[model samples]
Target: MDNTAKSAAILNGRLAEETTRRFTERTFRIFNDADHLSHLASKWKNVAADKAQGHMFEQLETIKFNYDALRKDSELFAKTTASMVLGTDPVDIIISDGKKTLREVQAKSCNHAAASTFALSDKKYAEMMRLSPSDQHAEIEKLLKQRIAAGTLKAGDYEQTLRNLKKDLQYDNVSSGGTTYQQATEATNQSVADRVADEFRVKSALTDMHESGKRAGNMGAAVAGGISAISEGFALFKGEKELGEVTVNIVLASAKGYATGYAVTALSKGVTHTASYYLGTGVASTLARSNAPVAIASGVVNASKSMIAFMQGEIDAEQLSDEISHTAITSTASFYYGAVGQAIIPIPVVGALVGAGVGYFIGNMIHQSGLLALGDSAVVKAAKAHRKQVEAMCLAAIPEIQRHRHEMEQMLSQHFAERKAHFTDAFSAMDAALYEWEPDNFMTGLTVINDQFGGVLPFKNFSEFDAFMKSDEALEF
Candidate 1:
């Protein structure tokens, strides 16, 4: 094969691999959720069938939401990957010169029928349109008044429902004359349209910032980590055994190391928390995408940074007393960055924090190495004693932890009797929902590939595309 064909084939293989990886991750998330909800359903088994069914439905919805998310991301990944392979600027692929963007492509993508019709109004537009002008106007006023009356909304606030409604109507050439039916009717229509458009615009801006932040956080963390690693490696290579002679030196270094190591982690966690209050693509998958690289950078930088910070006197040794070993263990654990290690704390932010705590462990290890190399003085002995105390306390907590675990297990058994059928049904339904989208997802990905090559694919339509994807050659992938 020619170089171009070989490159194209290689890109195709990569895209396929990436898509499968994404799909598997999403599937695991969906099933993990299904399992959790299944446990919840079992707990609620004593409750009414309707309540149990509600939990079951929630499990199904989680599966569908995650499945669709996977498809969308996979298609986006494919588009970007194809653009790169085809020598098109992938970053600008969504909006090339005088072209419709990824948003337009998404709208046109082959997909399932939506369960609900798109409404132009936030209100019951269909039902409201049936009413006379005066009634329609009254309904609009009622909604506004209801919102204002509720403590949740304020009349004077710029984004307040009532305030925005008045402004939208007036801006749209629809007078809000209190007594006129015609004016009220026009105002009602204008309000809904304006509100929806404004919401979409606001949401889009926030989404872009959030997505940009995800990449930025990863880059920042990676850079800091890389620098730290290089510096530390150089020190170790030179046989520089002592991090610092004084306690003040060690503390400053530990702080600086932590800052470098967790910079991306902190930003990613912060952005994720803030974005949760709004709408966006999401944080979980993006974080997952960058975790391995971030982890490696974090671990290396953290070790080096802590040692350097101590030598530079950024941290006081006084601050290092009694906490060296704990710090060492915690730092190491936090920066370890294994999927299974973080799995115990499902919430990424919490997991990161826990991991951060574990970083102290690494710091302590470094401190011990320094103490041994530089000769243990009074300060070092005190620090060592503190570390021993910390270890003793941790060992003392084991029995209590085991007792708590036993009690929790016994309690769970009480609520989980004879509920295997319900769990099976929920999981089966989730799998079925996911399967329905699989074909469309494959076609969508192929469409992106074809578009990237400027219609170079053998297929002329979706049917042909589908056939091509299902062939033995494609299946071999």
Candidate 2:
């Protein structure tokens, strides 16, 4: 192959590897890491007992369903979004009327064949074969159209299926058995269609926000995250029949923080614009920059409020420390990247990329400096002590977590058996009726490992998680 072709092949191979890695990396971590296994096991033990065990297993099933559903929904969302962007309709199913296309289906299913639905059984098939060639073709066409009109058969993606009422739909042979006589069938795949619609709305909203002249990167992140939070929150409510106070609190807090941060950033940008236009470039211009002051004030006020609440016995010290660290890190990052660094770049698309890269580097440097300066603070010391305590607690729970793994698996097995009883098809039985305790993919593997193991993973937070994930051992795993 030529150099260009060789380069393309190499990149394609890398893309495949990355995709595979994304799906399998979590499983690798859970299976190989003792700490993660123990933590998961502990969680399972706490929840997986008696009547509650069934619900816990169901949650696992829901998670697996969510993963597959999300992947499919995401693909559909992308296709639909692309079509919208390009000013075209998404066509997945179509009907051809002999000489030309009869219909391009964008909806969940076509209702063109709603009049008559029939499937030929084994006896009916034998009788059908006795008919002459012309008679057989005519009968088959009539039956097929009836089925199509009734939405009885799987039309499949974009393949041309004959739907002409004027001519005979030709086929080499007619084979029939089992449910050939389709009377009335409810929409079997509407759930997937509904999920795709939900994803489409989220994608559309994000696109709308981006087109509305907001900074594309920031707007994209906020919109996507906000939509996801809403979707997940709704799912939890629907599944559990009740929302937890802690869950609600966390969601509200996140939303509040995001809004506050956005306001601060926008106000800073406005101030920067005014200063640049009136004050001109100098020491005055530098001093006039709004991000540093706004960010610092925002962080201090939020963090200090939590800290003061803790001192007054209104909240725990751990919660206060978390607020402090979170505010400090986030505000520091925003100040550098969103404000100071972004101002240096003027190009739209290219400038965003350049600004983000420079901003992250500057942000990291400032964060490290700030951390060192604040090392002597009581909150910092408390956070460190709390971390140690958490680690010790997790380590101590390992054996108990290990014990619960088998119990959880037994619960899952029962759950699976009950579901299997409702299905006759082996494939369907395997798909929905069975739950694997030891899955090869990340999400299930993590769930299983934590349920079986006594303690959680050793990683302190996302930074540690990242470090471990990028390690040589992780790659090999």
For residue 350, give model 1's deviation from the true position in Å.
Answer: 3.5
- What's the TM-score of each model vs. the native? 0.21, 0.24
Clashes per prediction? 29, 21
Candidate 2 residue-wise lDDT, 182-267, digit = tens: 10011022333234333433332233222221232233235434654665677776784346653674465445444433433333
Best by lDDT: 1
True-structure RMSD for candidate 1:
45.4
Cα deviation at 309, candidate 2, in Å, is 4.7
Q: Which candidate number would show the highest TM-score if scored against the true structure?
A: 2
Misplaced by over 4 Å in model 1 are 1-296, 299-329, 336-341, 355-380, 383-477
Q: After superposition, how far is residue 140 of candidate 1 from its true place, in Å?
A: 49
